[model samples]
Target: MTLEDWGWSPFFAKQFRTWQSRGLIPARVIRGEKNYFRVWSENGELTVRFAGKIRHRADGRADLPVVGDWVAIESQPGRRGLIHALLERKSSFARNLPGRRKGKGRERIEQQVIAANVDLILIVCGLDRDYNLRRIERYLTLVSGSGAEALVVLNKADLCADPQYYQHEVEGIAGKSVVQLCMAKDPEQLDFLFDYLQPGKTLALLGSSGVGKSTILNGLLGEQRQKIGAVSDAVGKGRHTTTHRELFLLPLGGILMDNPGMRELHLWGEEEDLSESFTDIEELAIGCKFSDCAHKSEPGCAVRVSVENGNLSSSRLENYHKLKDELTNLHRRR
Candidate 1:
């Protein structure tokens, strides 16, 4: 397969100029294992590990290679190679990881890079017990800083009495992002997803466990490529069927990455990043009396006023404040 089939474009091509003269070939990381990674290059798929200098030079985890990152590799014997360098990413998404305690009474915050160079992120939510507006808000906020576009996919429409109602609620919160509803069990219901797929683009699935992420992947792939697990009837939650992150090339077009369902997603960027995901509140904040007005208990707060005037949902505002405060606290600690 050519590099374009794996989401390579002029953006990445420009960054790879320096590595071209060298013997190293550019490769996209498809799967990460315990001590090595599986990558695809012009020479075909190869099992590789990064050079020690690559790890020693990395300042943190975000600087290291992750699935979907294009890297410079030197081929070795037996379809094996060494990742000599990690090319710059055109788009990436990360979350705040609670790190070990640093000193007295405090823990450090670290960024965990989820995926790199993704063109789109599918925020999947099930209509069953997995449906949560607040959780969806959190996911959108997490996707805001990533250069990739976000699409809210509400799966399991069969489980919801009126999936359109939830879709509308999501559209209100999605801002410029699109919201789609589908029953992953039926392959036809997923036709809308293909419109966004293109040969040189990469899309990723993000959601909590048991949210039909695998079902959607299987449906789109036209095969049971991923193992599907049953959701617990007692807890109304899905088991961890997918344990790792991996990339797959679609037969029709586009590149898709299926990730292990995330139970908790923490905001990792600056508080200002909220403006993109919470555009409604940010637009209303423009009319606030004070420039530094915090939506809470402030006089002439247009955001809270909208909630009172029925222009915006109280729950959405509450989640905005919750996420804002969480990011503020995280930045303060940093």
Candidate 2:
């Protein structure tokens, strides 16, 4: 397959020109293991590890190459190579990695780039107890500023008698994103998802544990490529079946990255990311008398007025405040 089939485009080609003279080839990182990464170059697929300079040049883990990244590799004789540099990503999503609790307010925070060069993100949410509107908002916020479109895929329709009810709830908070319900085990119901897949495009699946992500991935692939784990009937939660992040090229087209279930999603982004996820609140704040009103107790506060007028839910406003506070605190730490 050509590099275009692997989601390469002019964005990467422009960056690769300088490396071409050095005999370095452009490769797309598909899967990452403990110490190395699996990448597909023009010659063929090869196992590769980044050069020491790559790590030394990186400011943080987010700068390191992750799944779905396009890198310039220095190939060896064998089916292996060394990654000398990471090409600039067209789009990437990251989260705050949990760090040691050094102290109360002095806790260390680090950025963890989950995937790079993605075109779309499937925010999978199960209709069972795994469904939570606030959690979905958090996921949307994480996707904001990543330069990729978001789709809220609510799976396990059979488990919830009123799956549409959950869909409606998600749509209320999903700004500029469409919500779809489906039974992941039933491949027939997943046909609409194919419209989003195409050559030179990449998508990622993100959600908490036990959201039927593996089931959905398998349905799209039309095979059992990734293993699925059982959910605890008592806890109504899912097991961390997918342990690592890997990208798969679809039989038809497009690339899909599967990430491990996240137990906690510590955000790592600017407060502006909230504007996309919390558009409703952001729009309402536009009418506020003050430009920098926090909507807590500010006079002529449009957001708080919406909550009082039943235009917005108080819980949603509270979540907006919570997420805003988290980002503000993160900026302070950084």
Candidate 3:
């Protein structure tokens, strides 16, 4: 098939030209397994392994080719390709390794790439009992820092008694760029999200389990490519649904990467995203008496005054400060 048929564009063509001059073939990694990958090349889908030079040059786990990565491959007649080099990533969403303690004898905070070069991140949160504004804020910070636009998708809207109330709550947090209040069971509601599915654009779905991410994928693909599990009504939670990350091309256009739900999203380094997500608080601080006011127990602090005067929720301000401290700590370590 031609490159256009596989969603290749001028951007990829230019990258491919540079690699071709260096006697390397261009391929897109379709799937990643342990120590191997399935790449889509000019010829067809070929299983591939990393070359010794590529393996030796890796800094850590982040150096490997993940789903949505464009790589340079060495091809041979009637044989699988060998990945030589990974192209520079346009964007990536990642997090620090969990259970990584701080201070002396601390384990290395490994970076796990969730997806690469994505244009949009759909932060799916179920309307049942799994919805948490704090969690959504965490995702917003991560996506904003990853250089991708974030859209909050509150799925299972049909299950809610008053969806508009919850929708307003999300709007209050997300501000602008809020996409749709969708029910994963309905196909018509899912079409609103299709506008972002233009050719060559890639999207990644991320959230906790039982948010109906797989059901949304089924609606978009018009088939059940991902397995959907039943959530327990007694507890209002789902069994760990997706166990892996996989990418699939939409029939209309664009690509979608479904990832396993993450219970914990420890911030790695996203100070800019935090500032962007909490722009109101940042703007409020500009009028403070001191430039470096802590906004807590500081004289003439506009932010603290706002919270005391009911202009801002105390809980919201608390969460913002918590995330700010996390970002500062992450920067110091880096």
Candidate 4:
């Protein structure tokens, strides 16, 4: 496949010119480990290590190459290749390191890049008991901030009698984003997903365990490429099937990045995305009498009024306020 088929575009092309002039070749990082990466270049897949300069320049984990990153590489005669530097990302999905401790008072939060340069994020949610609207909102905020379009994929539809019922609930929260329903166990049910999976496009499968992410991955590949974990009948949660993030080329010409199901997604910055994800509340805020309406006991508060009128769910508003406060605290710490 050509570079363009691997999701390379003019945005990355312009930035890669400098590296090309330096006699380094451009390669897309397919998989990344602690210190090494598997990249797809003109000569095919190559095992590459970070150059000394790159290591010295990197400030943190985000500065290094992650899956779906394009980098400049120097090939040695017989030894492993060296990655010089990473090109600027068109979009990146990141979050605060889960369960990592944070220092108080002005200490910057530790963030980890989940995937870089993703074009779309398939927020897979199961129709089973594992489904939670709040969890979907958290994933939406993360993807919306990454500059990638979010598509809510409701998998395991067979488990639920009425998939449309769940679809409507997601649409209410998703706003402008599309919500798709499918049963990963039945490949025929997943045919509709190909409409969004075009050639050269990159999509990331994101959801919690037992949400059928791995099953969906294998479905798209038309084979048992990823191992599927068995779900517990009592708890309805699946074991950690995918242990790491990986990029797979689809038979239909799209690139798919399958990530390990996150137990908790602690959001970082991207307050604007938070506003976008909750446009319903934002629309109501515009009609508020005060420019800065807290929506608590404020006079002529459209948001609270909507909540009272049954037009908006109070839980959604509570989550919005909670996330807004979290971001506000982050900004103050910064």
Candidate 5:
């Protein structure tokens, strides 16, 4: 497929003008492995690596090219392509890097970009034993600042006795985000997803392992393109079916990215974005007596009153405070 057919648009076309003037070719990263990448350009698929200057200029892992990223490359005959620069991303989904140790007592918070230039983030959740409202809230918080629209996909609906109940509950928590219910094995139930899968758009599937990301992707592709794994009875979790993130071209004309289930989604965003994710709590805080009320022991606190009056779920409030504290700590660590 051509670059445009792979979800490229005027946003990237304009960014590549300067590199084009220098005779560099524009390529979109379809998959990334270690330091090497597989990109789609005018010349078709090519193995590419980051140029030395590009690597030197990158602040950290977040600056590097990822799946769905567009880059300027210099192709060599019978050799690997050199990626000189990464075009500015129209949208990016990232999370705090996991398992980094403090070298000397300095806590450094680093970010890892999940996907670049995605138009929509499919926050997939299984309705079986894996479904949890708190987990969905965490995913929403992680996607709130991602520039892309977040769409919640409640997969495994056939397994749930009352799918509509779960769907409505998620919609209540998701606010402006759209929520859809479907069983990946059932093609008819998956039709609601097509409205957001317009041609030229990119959608990333994200959820915990065994949440049916691979199954959903295969259903959309009308084939077993992604390997599916069976869930274990002991742990009640699905095996890590998808080892890495890969982009696919849908037959109906859209870009789909299937990502490995994220076991931990450490948030990486501004503290203010939390309000956007938790509008219900944010709205309650406005009626608080103190403008800077901590919502803990302050007087005239609408938030605490809501919890006491059974208007707000205590678990939701608890998670909001937990995430807010996490973001505050992340900032200080950085």
Candidate 6:
């Protein structure tokens, strides 16, 4: 198979030129295990090991190859794959490591790498009791900060008697971009989401457990390629179905990655991304009396005025401030 057949482009070709001179082969990592990976090359799928130097040079887990990383590999005449170097990434989605004990005694807090080189982030939220606008805002902040476009997908729409109500809620947070509302089990409602499936683009689905991420992937694939687990009928929550990050090429074009649902998503110092995700709030803040207005009890604060007048939901503004504070704290800690 040629590089084009493997989704290589001029941008990747230019980066590969230097590695080519070093007698290395170029490949894209399709899936990653603990220390090993499965890469797609001209020779087909190959199980790969990281070069010792590459592994030693890594500072933490984020330095390793992820599902969508393009890498330079050392391939012999009849060998599998050997990853030599990681090419510069186009974009990445990441979050702070959770479960750390609080206090100054903590030495280091690691950043978990979710995915790399993704073009779009599909934030899936089930329309059942699992749906939360604040959670959607959190995902939006992470995606926007990652420097990738974000689209909100309200899965399990069939269960909701008033899907339009939730659709409007998501639209208030997701500006301009299409907010998809559909049942993970219905293809008819999924047709509206096909506009994002253009060739050469890579999209990643992210959400909490029982949000039907795997179900949505199965729906898009038109078959049950991914394992679907049953959600709890008592609590209306889904069990974690996908255990690893793996990329799949859609028959309709584009690539999709299914990742395990994360229970913790601490921010990673993305102040600008937070601003972008809450564009409505940012725009209103510009008209505040002071450039440095805190928007809390500040005289003539446009943000406060909007909230008081009901132009902006008080809950949304509260969430925005909460996220901004989180970003600030994370930045300082970093």
Q: TM-scores of all models?
A: 0.97, 0.97, 0.93, 0.95, 0.96, 0.94
Q: How close is candidate 6 to the true structure, as a TM-score?
A: 0.94
Pairs of residues clashing in candidate 6: 210-238
lDDT of 2 by residue, 54-141 (tens): 8999898888999999999999988999999988888888889866765665457888888788999999988888988899999899
Query: Over 4 Å off in model 1, which ranges?
Result: 102-105
> How would you encode candidate 3's per-residue C-alpha lDDT over 1-334 as one tens digit per residue?
5545445667667767877887888887878888788878787888899889887999977888888888999996665988888887778888877554556566556678888878889999988898888888788888877878889998998888998898887787785558468898987789888778976788888988888888888899999889988888898788878887777788888788888778789886667777778887888999899999878888999998998899887888898989989878777776
lDDT of 6 by residue, 1-334 (tens): 4555446788788888999999899998888898789888887888898989887999877887888889999885554778999987788899988554567566566788798888899988888888888988888888876867888889888889999998987898887656888787876567876888867788899988888888778878988899988889997766787889998888888788998988888887568886778889889989999999878888999999998899999999898889889888877877
Q: How far is candidate 6 from the true structure (C-alpha RMSD, Å)?
A: 2.1
Give lDDT: candidate 6, residue 26. 90
- Segments in model 5 whose C-alpha atoms lie over 4 Å from true places: 102-107
The C-alpha stretches of model 3 lying farther than 4 A from their native spots are 1-10, 77-79, 100-105
Better of 2 and 3 by lDDT: 2
Compute the lDDT of residue 20 as modeled in candidate 4: 93
The digit string of per-residue lDDT tens for model 4 on 137-218 reads: 8888888789899999998888899999999999999978999988889987888888888888999998888899988889
How high is the CA lDDT of each candidate model?
0.90, 0.90, 0.82, 0.87, 0.89, 0.84
| Model 2 lDDT, full chain set | 0.90
Q: Look at candidate 6 and tell me the lDDT of residue 44.
A: 83
What's the CA RMSD of model 2 in angstroms?
1.5
- Total clashes for model 3: 0
- Residue-pair clashes per candidate: 0, 1, 0, 0, 0, 1
Question: What residue runs in model 4 are displaced by over 4 Å at the alpha carbon?
Answer: 98-108
